[model samples]
Target: MSEYFNTQALALSKSFADAAFKAHTLAVEGLERVTNLNLKALETNVAATVDFLSEAAEVRDFDSLKTIFPKGVNLVKDSAEKFYANGQEVFGVTVKTGEALSQIAKGSFEVANDSFKKQVSAAQADFSKQVNGAAKKATR
Candidate 1:
């Protein structure tokens, strides 16, 4: 029955491959969900941070520039939301987006990786449980 064994082995290989493919697809979809949620959250945080800093940067001096030609930006009257660089002042709210974008980009990458792994593990576990249930029923 060597031929029989060979046929069984081939079938087993194909089945295993199919299972793995399905698992991968499920994992990827789950990862996307996690990414979407986190991305939305980050976008909100960025927007909020920009608004907060815009109202406070003049006091914080975040632009890293704004001392040489201090002719226009009056620190006292301007809304507390201002940033400067090289002694040059700018709208603090504008630059906060770039910083927020960077943070979200980096954080999203890490978060996606972690979520992918967790989802893969969960998919595999669920697949194994179903397979085991079938085997148990067949044996019974």
Candidate 2:
């Protein structure tokens, strides 16, 4: 009886530990992905800014300004397009992370539910057997 209880306790403890670990792993992965996305976006924007500044610095006179103005406009347009694309990519990552986390949560819940059901059924059977044994002893 002691051994049985010990085994059950160990099993429950292990299940809880496993569930916690899985949840932690999923959270970390999602955070890492978001961080990477933000970092990439920041890096791209910084590089674009540096390049634009360098081009603008080259403009010294009215004729040079005229030549640089169209290029500056094009640069702005290109930067806007890049930012739009990056935003889309970030959105995609966010959606994927959400779905992945949801699945993890759902799967863990189902497993825990099944484990609880099985434990309850087993306990009920054990209780019934013990009661039957006590009744036989009383009759004897």
Candidate 3:
């Protein structure tokens, strides 16, 4: 009986450990996705800013300034679109991570519930056998 209980306890501990590891792995992957998206956005913005500044620096006369005005407008429009696309991708990754986490939680809960039920049934059967043997010995 003691050995049976010990084995069950160890199995439960292992199950919990496995679940925690899986959760941590999912979180780290999600963090990496977000970090990569942010870095890409930052790089895009920096490049656009540098180009704008370079153009502005060359505008020494009215004609040069007029030439850069349209370019500046186009740069702004392009940057806005890039930012919007990056934001949408990040949002999609976040949603996918959320769904993955939910599935992990549900799977873990179901496994634990099933293990607990099996352990309980086994313990009940062992107790009944022990009781019957004790009663028979007492009568003899």
Q: What are the RMSDs of all candidates, in order?
A: 17.1, 2.8, 2.0
lDDT of candidate 3 over 70-98, digit per residue (tens): 98899899889988999999999999988
In candidate 2 the C-alpha lDDT for residue 116 amounts to 65
lDDT of 2 by residue, 1-140 (tens): 56555766677667767777877886788778878877887898788778888988988899989988887788788878878887888788778877877776677667767776777778788989999999999999
Q: By the lDDT metric, which is better: model 1 or model 3?
A: 3
Which pairs clash inside model 2? none
- Model 1, range 1-140, lDDT digits (tens) per residue? 34434654565556556555655665565556556655655565566566555655555453534441242244322322322121122223224434554554555455555555665676677779989999999999
Question: What's each prediction's clash count?
Answer: 14, 0, 0
Worst lDDT run of 10 residues, candidate 1, spans 82-91
**Candidate 3 colliding pairs:** none
Model 2 RMSD vs true structure: 2.8
Weakest ten-residue segment in model 2 by summed lDDT? 1-10
Instruction: Please identify model 2 stretches exceeding 4 Å from their true place.
Output: 1-13
